[model samples]
Target: MARKMLIDGEVAAVADGGHYDYDLFVIGAGSGGVRGSRTAASFGAKVAICELPFHPISSEWLGGHGGTCVIRGCVPKKILVYGASFRGEFEDSKNFGWEINGDINFNWKTLLENKTKEIVRLNGVYQRILTSAGVTMIEGAGSLVDAHTVEVSQPDGSKQRYTAKHILIATGSRAQRVNIPGKDLAITSDEALSLEELPKRAVILGGGYIAVEFASIWRGMGAEVDLFYRRDLPLRFVINFRESLLLLIL
Candidate 1:
């Protein structure tokens, strides 16, 4: 027998009066998944969200609560950029008759360590937010078992299953390496953020924001950067007016 279920104001036929472990089960605890699950829980829906274990460098089996933006993407990149921008700041300070006493040195280890600490702290904060919101936080990789069921594989070779009235697959995107020879030799933005030592020289291949941003970052940090792109100009899809600014910055 089938009964109509009202979900998000939509009526759909489901198994009549079927029992569910949660009202909503989200398969990824990335930004999208976390936001959706938290919102659903706020609305009195019993929500459970599953994510892979915490890791700055994401893999198929390892992602954290706050997703790419917080864990490895924007936050870390911005922190590095802020650190690199000090060089220009120091130079500009010279124009204001501010004389520096000693040789200015950038400590890569200290910055890297602090950045990692901030990331870990934010991970804990996200967990606390979920706990406060009444969203069950499950640490594992989740897979769809059926339309209304999810199976999670834990870190210790254990699996758990849960049924839900509605399932949300908010698994985020992953960076794809180009299908070229020696692709494995190239590091994605993920690895670029967590480099043990600052690069002395870097060659970036691509015209997207990531490539341009890295080029600027490395160059600002005193690395020789060469950017290669297939298009006549990098960021061809960006607004025409911003092209000149990007050119000057890069």
Candidate 2:
């Protein structure tokens, strides 16, 4: 059944809301889902968003609010980068004729604890935002049961079904660990951010942004880093050619 939606100088077929519990049902409470639900709710649409329960460590059943960017991706990575850069600063100060006498060391536990606290705080903030926007936030993993119905599996093994006029999927991404021998011994960037001890030797095996960033981070913090990529040039496609050339020259 084709339905009509009013758009910019156009009418398009939209979801038919003959019998829906909500006008909008979002699958994930990541940045996109939260924003979309909030916007729809502000426009007087009945919106409900579902997500996994909050935890410092993420898994299939324990994804927190704020999604990848807020929890495991950008926020935590940048915090680690900032903490790691201090070693570079201390080293560079010697060139500037500053006499520093103390033995500097990095505390992985301290940084991890602080980062966890900050992410927890941000999660609460996102929850409050959803509440203020009048969006019903459900805690669970949502899947499409039908075109207009979502089935959520909660952490406690309970399930709930919601029918909506339109459903949104914004469950965000996860780190893909490469398959190899002894793969369990290796950690992805997500785990790297929360390591209990800084590694003395590290080998990163990718040319992507995350790989290179982790390489730089560990190297800056006094780790022996060997980055391996299939291509002769690292970050070849991602970095601007001229900028990469300049960096290599330098």
Candidate 3:
């Protein structure tokens, strides 16, 4: 039996009767999966999506709605970009001869609060977009039970089985969150986006965009910053010529 759902002012149905089949089944709610599902739904296909449980780190079994990119990666990273961009704005303000006051201290809490609020708001908007598109948003981790069949472990510990004409997986990549002493204490970009305070000193530990952006942000806000990258050269515009000429997954 297919379910019935409404999108925008129109209506789309997945199962109007009993247990129903879907034209498309999506695993993970990242940008690609959701976008594909929505586009398919818009074309009058019955679509369903399964999202894993939420965690600071993303994985097939321990992911959340909006996938890694939304909950932990792209969204958070872009927010940091927005935060870092304020420095340029302030510089421009100075160039415009808007010299006004005393020492301007950085307030990390304000941006953090607003970031949290915006993420929540975007999450809701994502949900609404799916619902309005008549796409089924399943909350759980999906597994390939058999050919053409997918089994989902829901948040409440229940299991659901679905058969679909097509299945899409778009979980996106996870950060290389390391494990070591105080590793758990270290903040990923997810938390960095909502930092409570701009530390007087910061030691960045990766060659990734998140690390570099934080370095820029903290330094811009008058914090001492030490950036450490594994490679001899920084990631930006660096090229290497190695002897090995072959690398293929297949």
The TM-score-based order of candidates, best leading, equals: 1, 2, 3
For residues 1-250, could you state the per-residue lDDT of candidate 1 as single tens digits? 0111234432222577547787788988778888888888776777889999998999978999899999999999999889989989999999999999999998888999999999999999999989999999888999999988899997688999988878999998877799999999999999999999989999999988889889878999899999999987887778685578767768
Error of 2 at 154 (Å): 1.9
lDDT by candidate, in order shown: 0.86, 0.82, 0.70
Model 1 residue 143 CA deviation (Å) reads 0.5
Q: Estimate each model's TM-score.
A: 0.90, 0.87, 0.74
* Model 3's TM-score against the true structure: 0.74
Which candidate should be chosen as best, given lDDT against the real structure? 1
Per-residue lDDT of 176 in model 2: 74
Which is the winner by TM-score between candidate 1 and candidate 2? 1
Per-residue lDDT over 66-132 for candidate 3, one digit per residue giving the tens place of the 0 to 100 score: 6556666677666766776777788789889989588665567777666666666666778888899
Best by TM-score: 1
User: What is the Å distance of residue 33 in model 1 from its true position?
Assistant: 1.1
Q: What is the lDDT of residue 75 in candidate 2?
A: 93
Worst window of 10 by summed lDDT in candidate 3: 241-250
Measured on C-alpha atoms, candidate 3 has an lDDT of 0.70
Q: How many backbone clashes does every candidate have? A: 0, 0, 10
